[model samples]
Target: MFARSLPIISLLSIISLRSVSAVDYSETYVGCVSGTGTSGALASPNVNTISDCNYACADAGYTYAYFQYQSAGSYCSCKNVGPSASEITPAVSGNTNCGGAAAGVNALATDYYYNNCYNSPTAEDTTSQSTFDACFERCTTYTNAFVSPAGNVYSCVCSNTASTGTAQNCGVSGTYFAYAHTATSSPSIVERRKRRLSERLKREEQTRLNRFCPAGLEACVIPGLDDSFECIDTSSELESCGGCLYGSTGNSNASTGIDCSTLPGASFGGTTCSAGRCEISACKEGYNLVEGRCDWHV
Candidate 1:
């Protein structure tokens, strides 16, 4: 009876040893990536059912994964998959069971090269406000076609072939985002022409104000006043200028007076010209000379 029992125990021991060896040994080969489909060692790449793929990587000690969809079927591998594993570096010619063994490898290599080579905990290229804004705009338009994954933020992965954009993980946290519209031109010439016209109108209005109003009174020109001028008194002019208008009024005690010295390129204590076209020399302090008239000091 002990002999029979000894055989049984020996068989059990062999089975146990095999299991331990399987667990201890590491297998390297070219296959598809698995879980998260993002970048970094944290992502899982075991090719299995989404759920199984999720756990297979953990069981296989891999954190990242991808699934290579091909004419035959899907295949999976861990982070260890490489050209040497299948005797086919990305440079090698001919086809192999590995998805990256064909001419298509160029595109796949681009994706893998960026995702695996530049793995970072922070968003890639998101160092400035402008970059963030541009990336955000692209993400908004492209939606999920590209992903910038949160933790593996160095590169973006394209979801489908229809997507014509790249993923940019902008930010310190490796946040994944998509950026489309590369190599695309800007608005058409007609659109630019319209924008230029609008800008020109603004400049014209500003030029008119500079020609007529006191130096600082440019801000006082109300919007849409194409050909209108208001005869503002000294106090009103001073308020518009944010201070007392520098210039002597013909009638110093007069409540209403125009100080031309406030105009540009005028000298202090210059001529004073009122709204009625009356002019006076030797104006009060803060006034300036402008075209033989005392302009308000700005």
Candidate 2:
């Protein structure tokens, strides 16, 4: 009895495993489904046909390929998982025009193209449907995503209903049908632009601030003038020897050099500014040199 039970248990386990796993029809056409692009799946729009859609998915290494048609337009997307039962909206047709692996397709006025095997297209959309399509699936924000072709990657552009030319056939990378489905939430594309703009503004403001005085130099008002100033090295200025001779109000963290030659009681050529302070080498007969200053003799 124990031996018989073990065999039955093993067989049941095998059946369950087979039943639970989904089929891998990679590159093959299984069937279609319903709804818009797969929820949160990497998707593309304007793929030419289901055939191209299949290659697009396979090339992108997704488990399944999803092609959709609605009042807006046709779209293609790759997903690792098949659509939910609610999204299994099919449009059965006996037409095999696009060279699908199946004899007929499930195309309808509004369609959510899908397959049982689960992978989408891997190859480029031979149709003008690509370009705005890739590095392929990075732009899955709102449905109005467009692209600017650069080196090897794409500059995905984000837009909404407010953007112009929703009906116009795309003319940037190639001629292609257009689709529009504005989303209420902003995606990476818009967020990235905002962050970059903020960074640029901060940089510009810093540049303007530093223009008044270079890093090591100080901006000093030219004494009797209102709107004029001069750049002075505060660490060793002779006139503004120890610090700025006169400064209106400004950065609490800047050096202000003083004028050593302007000290009273010091004769010409008797006093000199060195380092950042006034030094008295010799004083007039009426004054005595004390420490570094020219003091009056008592």
Candidate 3:
């Protein structure tokens, strides 16, 4: 009798372990992300359903759980930063298998999940931004910017003049890690990240037809504008990788791509846009790729 019971118990244990990612979960739904993930991934779990994977992610003490459609619902991992996920990472929006906001977007083994950085203080020109590198990329046309990151939300404000805001607590009433621009030419190491988001919203419509794009191109909405968009070639765009989008937007914009150029501080030719991400052979200078966005040094 003891022998028979021991085998039964062992079999049950094996079955339980195998079901960790076998179905969908009822946890609050987050948005879908595309492109590859930044490092810090644990060995992924194997399951067969979105519900089951969501449960597994909760068990792992993460706020979000993501899986790939090609995995047939088995390959998945846990994350704490989600819902307000990585808009900085491009996407393949309209994927029904991902099981999140709107019709649904999809994820790849390389897809990323990130925390939301919010803008509490609110600037005159703000956009959905996550990392300092992303903010820097957005402000490529401006001389200054303000980045505010709050829980589950992130944003960057672009400006043409250097700001006195500095790295202060202005976004969320002291609940922010806000960075402000200090100079027109360069910034102090600390200010580099704060004012990094100075100019990236400037548009060049000389070669664009807003209502529609020529073949081999897609229309992407421009941030800080009203019903405005740009035509781009996802295959080679630095700002719209993979597909095309400003952030983790819905299919309404027609695309959900990441800004592959957000790998700020990258040495000339250090980072390249491949499909939908900023791929690099190695990190040069004071740069680190965290959660799919470049860290613009301290």
Count the clashes in each prediction: 47, 36, 35
Flag regions of model 2 displaced more than 4 Å.
1-215, 248-257
| CA error at residue 66 for candidate 3, angstroms | 1.5
lDDT of each: 0.30, 0.41, 0.42
Indicate whether candidate 2 or candidate 3 has the larger TM-score: 2
Worst 10 residues of 1 by lDDT: 1-10
Winner by TM-score: 2
Provide the global lDDT of candidate 2 against the true structure.
Answer: 0.41
TM-score of each: 0.21, 0.28, 0.25
**Which digits, one per residue and each the tens of the lDDT, describe model 2 over residues 1-298?**
0000011111111012211212112232323344445577656655656655554443333445666654355666666554332232223432112222211122111111221111111222222222322311332343443333223333334433223433321212321222233243324433443354344445444445447887766566565676666776666666776666676224322445555666767777776666667787877779887877778999
Report the C-alpha lDDT of model 3 over 109-188, residue by residue, as the tens digit.
11112222223444567787654445645665555555544444455676654443333222223333223332343334
Candidate 1 root-mean-square deviation in Å: 27.0
Q: Tens digits of per-residue lDDT for model 1 on 143-234?
A: 22233323222133333223233432222133332323322221232234334434444554446555665653432322244444443343
